[model samples]
Target chain A: MKNKIIAFFLGLLILSFAACKKDVAQDQYEVNPVKLYPSIGAKNKNKTQEQYVSILYTNLFQRALSGNQLVEIIDCLESIGDKELGREVLISNFMNDPQVVLPSDSVMRANPDVFTEQTYERFFVRKPSEAEKTWFRNFIEANPQLSAEMIYFAFALSNEYLYY
Target chain B: MNRRKFIRNAGIAGAGAFAVPYILPSGRLFAATGRQLAGHVVYVLFAGGVRQQESILQRYLDDSQGFPWAGNIMYNMFNGPSPENKIVYGTNQGNGVEGGTPIPQILSQTLETQGTVFREVQAQSAGHFGGLNNLLQGSQVTTQGLKQKPINPTIFEYLRRHGGFPASKVWFVGNGIGNGLPLLNYSNHPNYGSQYGANFFAPSITFGNLGFEHLSNAKVYHPENELDPMYQMKYFLDQSFANVGKGGDSLGNTEDEKQDIKSFMRSTYDRVTQNAIPFPTITENNDALNIGFACEIMRWFKPAITVVNLSSVDGCHADFTGYLRALHRADHAVGHLWNYIQTQIPEMAGDTVLIASPECGRNLNHNPIKDVNDWYAYDHSDNNASRVFTVMAGPGVPQNLSIGNEANPVGFTSDNVPTIGEILGVKDEIMGAGFLQPESVSLFDRI
Candidate 1:
């Protein structure tokens, strides 16, 4: 009787081990990867106020910047400071002011590493005119990135903004 | 790992989730591939700076003599007979162009037969390039310093990649100005050269007509090198199964490598042949070029997106003597193309989504003759120029939607992507920097 009891306990242990193994195996399979990136809501909660402002400015400029929004952009730039040079390069390129002029030809020469041959030409030909020069300068002086974004935003607002 | 071993391990481990298809399922899979619902896109760029007044709307509701001839025509066509003689009367308040610029008769008939969908697509830029970029890219992005190519990919690229279409199947036909390197050519997919594809023969050879024979000749002579690099890539991906027989791995294996090699071989051949052709000629005449391309597309390769860019509209802005004629001709081309799509590819007729909008709204401030150098140079009228008219009609779209006073009616411009995406049952991913997705008000919703 004792021998029978020992056999039964041993059988139970084996079964339990098999069951655990099966469970672990089953857990391994997955379908349609759970998204790698977290949702915007979750990500936003962790960002600092400075980060938030940066995102906002980046987002706005990335669209298009118009002459009208120069003042607001200037304010944003003053707040962001000088550490951001990549952004500054973009701003300086756009300003084309007498103090910090980046001519189209020079810009073409500078952009070999960044812009493709075709893209560089298309952009160079359509430079911002003399009238838009001042607003561009003031903003570049205030902000870090040339905010090439203004053109896009300006275009969008120009088309979307209600005139009446 | 070998696919069989991988599968076995996966099954044994119950890692079925990892085996799930990696593609973000574009719901259009069940769609018919061949001639079934095989459609094309017709872009109607009503150039010649359309004025909100005299074109579509009347200047004053009270003044009887205020209505212009164009306004009277629009009222008669769209609004029909009315007691007040105002076509839209009370309905079209605040929607610019009070008198109503009646769509040319040809387009109207085509719309009626083939089914139509229309929207007042919004744009961000008022300038030609800016507006063109917005429409072509379906959104706006900073074109300033970085020169990282335009952020908004054209519909052509989106359709080719996400829409399960071949690049060769898309056609870009230029009107009046013939064809030049399209300013809107920054797509992430293959771009057809003006000299090749459907319009193989030049004007000198074809006698101002499309040389249909040349299409066959071109295909036969260059059958091995028909597709652009992107199409070659896709075809390679499709035939990736062929590599499995050579005792190679499946996932990241020799088969995939072979496929890449095949694509490269095909691409190199195409690049050489494309450059070999004489610089493609630009023709001012549409005649057979427009109609013939339409028919061939319907009969042979049913393209997903076909852009018929009418340059005469821009010509009008230049005060060219025949601007009106060009406008009329563009109207006719649009009409003819619609007829062919409906009659020949009847399935496409219903399923197709046709969008007719101007590249940019013409300046309301200047007349073509008055502003010679800046004739068309009405600095972008903020959103006013962006508020150009768009008419859409096709399968799975609504007929008439009263976009009544939705504060910020997201009509027109790049918002078109999300709207188109909703119709196509895919995620609208072709967003530009700061391109907030337009509120997806699909034609399906109203229809």
Candidate 2:
């Protein structure tokens, strides 16, 4: 029993000495230099990084963050998107899941304006004004690259998603 | 002489009809004392009802369970050896055959040898959320409810507002989001709401499956992909916030600070993957994981203030043996954390101050159910649940000082707020704020 106790004390002594290698100037505070953490993007990305990351964590990752761990948040989002194939299945399932369901072509032909209310109500959380609607319809025509899935993904990653 | 008295005398108004308001209860806060004794403070809400006898007093099972054991399982904080009996709480790797080697007491000097202790502290509430509110907000509000914002300002707000510290400098790192723990980083008080709130995040969630799924690549989207999700997710988040009653949670950092945190988190990931940062040997326990990540935050940002919560021991409500094991492990996690702070983190080595106390304590009597080992579990609903202790350790604290007792209690659970405020040079500001209990005196003042 005494030998076991001695071994424990001996171990502690070794651990303690191991950490004391760096001799320090006793009263001075040693802080890491400025820009110690590296940010990768240009000013625009950096400016909106908090809002973007906030939306992703809140909506997709489904949690609240204090906003300190941005790298991990982005890393988390990309990995989800990397599984876009698996998530394509999820997206389609979610489309069928009450919230984002769209009318069939024949059904939509009979009630073309039905989707306008649904789109504004579901996407913006509010109905769009007539001027706003006209601008959006023109904008969609002018930008052929904008797809419905891309639009959903865009809203999921937007600054507007996080702003009060 | 007074207007009210004159009105009563003139029979123009009934004397009891006029409402008298107290100064302290009025939500308006006062200025800070500005005694800033330390650069940083790590307040460990060492929660989930730890009893004094089982903890600081080191009365293992002799008192609570009627066993022959009577020694300290928590050798790092208090001075003593663990009890002599079935010590199953220590890590056991051998399929319950061989116990993991007990972590050697990490601190050469026990917290008691290096700091002051309040042997008896009165936790105002036996319930989890209420006790937590009292501990962080520094006032016992019996009317406070759950799933809503705290009624009074937290120490986080007091420190941030009075000390001119940014949101990143104040952090509340919760172990898990269980028990509605995430909502506590800010309060509902209009004067000092989310803007003065602490930057709070659950590390377990961030570093676990969530991190793996979404953040691994962090691929930036094209302009077209970006604009589409904006409106849709807004509606989702708006409803979510409205449900929680904090309709808007501003990230609360300047653009530079936000960028700094982003870069730091990025740098941290690179260093971590490269093995530049020392990851402590982890255990299966959630408390240990929390301590690990908390140490990471302190090392990376060295936030002026950091708060951690340990609640695994809450298992005591059903399984006493599990509770005992969790308590023992909680001590072990704390020991590793302090050692890391003292030895590994050069920035916080000598500059940091640490304070810890349970949110509340379990009842003195045992519950009806028994574990496989036949040890009975305990509940915290009894008034005896208010019995708890507080520990403070750092250079600024008086070494080896002991205060309070069951017979003549000296402090309330709320006292920790003003006490830490005093240590960090914000005592006057915190007390002057007037939201805390007027009687919650600083430990420095008591000394």
Candidate 3:
């Protein structure tokens, strides 16, 4: 009877402990995952907000924003922040404000490592994967003329940053 | 000892619910393998229940008031006599005498002369949303609850998956975004979901003064000297993201496609700023604004398929006269938009097909309320509310064709989707997917 009690308690303890600790290794996952990320709300409730989603979208194709709303909407705000606010204060600042800048080519040339680390931490929330670091470094070296904002923007607006 | 430390660390990391985002999936999982018949389709979810008597039957008051005061108030789509003695729908600003506008009537032609219409169509649901669901999804999902993702896939999904059309090619230009109208672009079906969805936006919200200031002719950010501003912008974006409630994911465009869309968006914004396209002049009515934008979309993208909702006429619950005015204006808007597509949009003139239907009809019995015009107000909850009509015109549609009069009722509103599928050349694959309501059939086939 004593042995049985110990076994049962042991099982209970194991279950409790297992539930508490998520592996840190799993936390980082893959920087460039082999499989496509499930879209926001597809597999589960995983999607970045407009800023990250929009930024990720823009960096992929460096330029202006689109006039249309192509992405998903919430149950409450069927369209978005009151359209006037979305248009006037919010979206305008993201796309129009010239002061709202990306990294210039010269700055990126001067400090690629710092820019890279900041990107991984801010966007991916982790250290750069060797593959990602190597590829980006080569990209910068080859296109030394690319702006600093381009690299930062890439990470910030990357689909990776859009972790659901 | 370290196990406790690991647990603590994991808790901290998981606390914010932050984690590395999985890469977004891309590639045409299902190429629009469906056949292509019509180059473009413009569908109008003519919302708010239109009573058979007031609309198709043109029975102005015989049934309601026991008087034969009937005339064709909706003259644009149907081939019937004009509401000559009754012209209350137009603007009275001319002489301040009420009920008149100089806006020339569309003399080009009526829909009956060029298309097929079902006068005694059967609408599955009397409610606006479900009726719209039936129209878009081609189903009669009686259990579909209000303000939720549709269980079945929408026509938008079929167009993308079977037709192999890109997201850029499909659009849902909505009226002011309310009543969950914006949510109809895609559905929650696992197989056919948001990835194959339409781009929806309320033009009034996105194209007014605010839009002019921000989106139209906007400059790209420099990003170099703008770090602080970027931070501020990021903060705003983060807040917007944070405010978003609940979740249901949709498919996203590829990086290149997204950029392509962005460029197109910029060009469209620029065009709006420059007033390059002819935006119809709408003074009093709200539905007219939506129609005008529909014309703008046709001119801009020439989208393979587009759906717009007209809801201003749903005002019949109280204001009978007002409902008539709005209904009349709705017809005028459709007429103007259709005429623009034919006479102005050279590319889509002959190739495009148009479909229009009310969600359902109103109740036969009158409500207690009476309008200022002394006409009785009617609500929609009776068996008669299921009675509605369908109008379709384009290349493949039989001209001067009228099917199923009131006595010999012969069609369902759900058939519109399959009819659209047939017209667009994807009926077989869409039907093969097997989500459409069993009753759904191509009106063209029926004809």
Candidate 4:
């Protein structure tokens, strides 16, 4: 009788374990998505040198938290309202799950040293090759309307560039 | 014989009634509703540690670069200095304790006349959180036994409660440094504590107990008892203030103590809560420029109390790629915001108060990595962070006044709450072993 009772108790414990595992797996599939959109006039349309530079300037001015720039950028694009797509298209970008690990603060504490092309590629936006960043920097500078200082500031402020 | 009789008849009630009329509980003078502004506050939480060697102080001492930004803005504000400009160029004494250089010129020439400045002349605690807590909560507490939560209610609460101010009346915004909500002190409120709705961020707002109306209505100030970072804080504060009565909580203490409790609860609770305001959009630019944009936008809302945390200066301390650009932009933003405030809110132009201070000092030592004063560790523990420069000016304030004595910039504790309270027309209420014990009278008194 004692042996039969012990075996019955062990079976009950196994059933409880199975129930807990199922509960844990129930919530794992949930995904929270962040929105992204094309640049205001970039709806398959090429932008002017001035217009592109302005976009770059806005991006540079608003570094890490670039989403907030949407309101102002949209306001400026009012002249092109007829050409505009849905307003929400501006912020419709696919993002890694918010939980994705990024570089630690200790690694990027020194703002200049940490913001290299390789660092950007590893953590933030897809890493543009150093050559590409340099090229973009130069392009921004040569446009007399914009200066090297302005291009450098844009990169510094870009959310794609600012955060890991 | 007649004089002796008169003296004998002089009762305690007669003498007491003759004391200060301000002490008496006359008819409640509730604030006018139209006079009320559903505005936001842009407090430049200038951290601790500013020496006369840098910025404006340097300008006064013939070191032109000391206050480059202030110099540029002053030049722009006024076509040129008139005879009224009492710009005194001088240096702070050699002692390190006496901040680097003293510039009475800027104070007199620029701040004093603007009537937008609010200077806190009486000094108090000099440590980082010590000075900040005093400034933010309007009460000074010691560094050793600091509570995890605010003991004395904050200004955000009081203004919201008593004034029937909206939740969006006050805001504590930053340029996406991830510091989260600036003041989580309201977490102690029964309806709003740190755990229930501690932070004013997206995640916290989405899950918290705060009403959905606040979430839906970003434009209108929704008065509710929920934990939307924007709404609940204002509601909690406003309600606390409206709840105040004269006869309650005498606490069997002296008349002064009774007054202190009454004032502290009424003012601190109302100001902090009533002004739960909107967060700024972190648009493209340096933190300074972002702060400037928010400050300008906030002028439209006209928050009664605003805390504009300029994060870019911290960028300057790190000497990032565009540090100087960021700093210059920040300077420009301050200038623009000041111009807008003066032009748009003519009522506040003279009556409103403007205060500029730093959060903490940077390492004077040039080295970035090995520099002893990096974020991980630095001089603040000692007195290195003790010395900083603060400027204040506004209506009813004295012009070109220096808090430090003539021998030095006036030396007082970092507990400058009394001065702030005076400017806002609230009495200095918090009192205790650590809180801002009103040492000198109003900061307005120095004006």
- The candidate that wins on lDDT is 3
Ranking by TM-score: 3, 2, 1, 4
Which lDDT tens digits does candidate 1 get at residues B1-447? 999999899797776565544552222333322232224555544553443332233332222222342322323113332223433322222456432222335344434233433334455666555655556566666651122334545555455445654434544444332222233434322231111121111222222212111111111112233222223322332232133222111111122322332333234234334542111121234432444444443444455566555444455444422333344345455556666676767556665677666666544454435222222323335455555655566664445543422143436555555445444433344332224335423333433
Per residue, candidate 3 scores C-alpha lDDT tens digits across B17-129 of 55543322323444444566679999998857888887888765556655666777778888777555545556676756466553456736788788888889999999888
Q: lDDT score of model 1? A: 0.39
Residue B92, model 2, lDDT: 68
Candidate 4 docking category?
Answer: incorrect
Candidate 2 deviant stretches above 4 angstroms: A1-122, A125-164, B1-33, B93-101, B220-247, B264-282
How close is chain B to the truth by TM-score, in each candidate? Answer: 0.58, 0.84, 0.83, 0.52
Give all candidates' CA lDDT scores. 0.39, 0.67, 0.69, 0.36
* Model 2 quality (TM-score): 0.68
Higher-scoring candidate on lDDT, 1 or 4? 1
Residue A91 of model 2: what lDDT?
A: 30
Worst 10 residues of 4 chain B by lDDT: B198-207
Model 3 CAPRI quality = incorrect
Return whichever of 1 and 2 wins on DockQ. Answer: 2
Best by DockQ: 3
Comparing 3 and 4 on lDDT, the stronger one:
3
| Clash count in backbone of candidate 2 | 27
Give the per-residue lDDT digits (tens) of candidate 4, residues B1-447: 598777766765578667734321211134422232112233565533432323433222122222232222223122233212212211234534222222222122354345323222333444445555555555554532343455555554444333333433444444432332233324244422222111121212211112121121112111131112222222322232232311111112222322332232233223324532122221224443445434443544455665554544444334322232233344445555555566666544654566655544443333333212121212333343444545554445455555552235442333334444444544323232133454544444544
iRMS per model, in Å, is 24.5, 12.6, 9.4, 23.3
Tell me candidate 4's TM-score on chain B.
0.52
